[model samples]
Target: MEIIVTPTAEHLELDAARLNSHPQNESRLFPDGEVYVQLESVADIESALVVHSGQPCPNQGLAYLYGLLDLLTKHDVLITLCFTYVPYGMQDKSFYPGTVNYARALLDHVTRYPVRQVYAIDPHFSHRDWVAEYPVSHLHAFPLVQQRVNADLDDYVVVGPDLGAVERFGIPSYEKTRNGAYEVELEGGLDIEGRNVLVFDDLIETGGTMVAAYDRLKSQGADTVVAAAVHGVLDEGIQRVQGTYDGLYLTNTIETDAGNVATESLVQTALE
Candidate 1:
């Protein structure tokens, strides 16, 4: 059985190639008895299944996805659509009035295609049931991120930028207080002091919040500060705080020129 991977700017080919080596009963239905094909902007088809990682930006648009759908439909091939949500910062719930339901709207738009399955890493949804509109697969990136952090760091406390993340990420986190600007408070007014801190979130847009968190952790006597997210959307402010934190780990859910402090080692495990 062969597995073909579609190419995007993201460095997922190595991991995909690794996933191809393992055989599954699901491969029996493929044409020529081969199960994998990879689709990329550059034509280096190494697997039996075609995987296309076309740019989905508005300018580039969904033309590639549409084309792939047409090809799959014509050939009667079952296709799975896999993507992550860092490029577009998905705040599942609206914080203020007149804000758009970005996550739900995006899913609705993407599901309009004829893909059989949808795979997502670390979505910002409040509940899994919110994605029930589409009859496809959705994978959470939190457990994967947690596993990576847990493997790398011991004697560490999880830090959340705010209370929202504490609930969303399902971990104990320190809330950044408005007054101190560089202070994070734990439950019962306890502050994280002299402890190794691991800050986890779904995405990092600019480095503002993260940088502030780093300072706050330092002020509170956190021995070291490490920030990890599923997506690294280093926008304009990233330059200001690139070196502020000790380590910034992220997954290859989006394409970015900004190098990650660490790449997720749990890619292989997540596939399982």
Candidate 2:
């Protein structure tokens, strides 16, 4: 038997229903904020697949993942970990004195487990190339973004929130926009007047950067500004400035209470 586990209830909701037919596992939190996982049943599981949508609760997903891995290890089952929104992917490098490379730290921690493979969907990596003992796949959501943008394309241009996003998207030539605490700046001198613009990135958290970009695009006379991201962690900042965006699109990389575009087929592609 193959067992599929979701780290939390939110994750279980995001996972495909076909996978849900099997026994499900749940995690509970003690009053002290400690996590304890309850595996329903796995008497004779041959392999395991973990499908986890991220959480705002810091390290909660990781703790739950480790717990599942421990159980699978005891069963000597091959395991595959699929994290729709990889935690700490933004902290891929050391930025200041005594600061740890959290991205690497996360990878190292998971590598210690008997995980046969790992999928970090739409990861924000400092480097494209990596070598790990087990297979580590960096899946992209560009196709999904492209589909969303294709529905209506007229006088449209793909935009990047920053220079790095521009480089990653690799659109031959595009408008450049940057976000600052107080304001945003548009560079590259591409005229956006009366143009429909589509901005995309790997993830959107807090949305301060997207808000800045959206505001600047409108000021430059952009006809319409739509934003899309692989992971939608639209926190307080987005909540505060929801009306600033013309249309907001997000993938199911992370499960939230809000309605988001489904990403199950895209995830299935990675699994196959």
Q: lDDT (0-100) at residue 116 of candidate 2?
A: 73
Which 10 consecutive residues of model 2 have the lowest summed lDDT? Answer: 16-25
Q: Summarize candidate 2's per-residue lDDT along 15-105 as a digit string, tens digits.
A: 4322122223332666577777656465467776676665565478678777777877887877777777778787877889999878777
For model 2, the superposed segments whose C-alpha errors exceed 4 Å read 1-3, 9-27, 126-134, 152-155, 172-186
The numbered model that scores best in TM-score is: 2
lDDT of each: 0.54, 0.66
Which residue pairs does candidate 2 place in steric collision?
none
53-130 per-residue lDDT for model 1 (tens digits): 323352232343444455455555544555544223255656699987676766676566555556655556645466
Top candidate by lDDT: 2
Summed over model 1, clashes come to 19
Model 2 lDDT on a 0 to 1 scale: 0.66
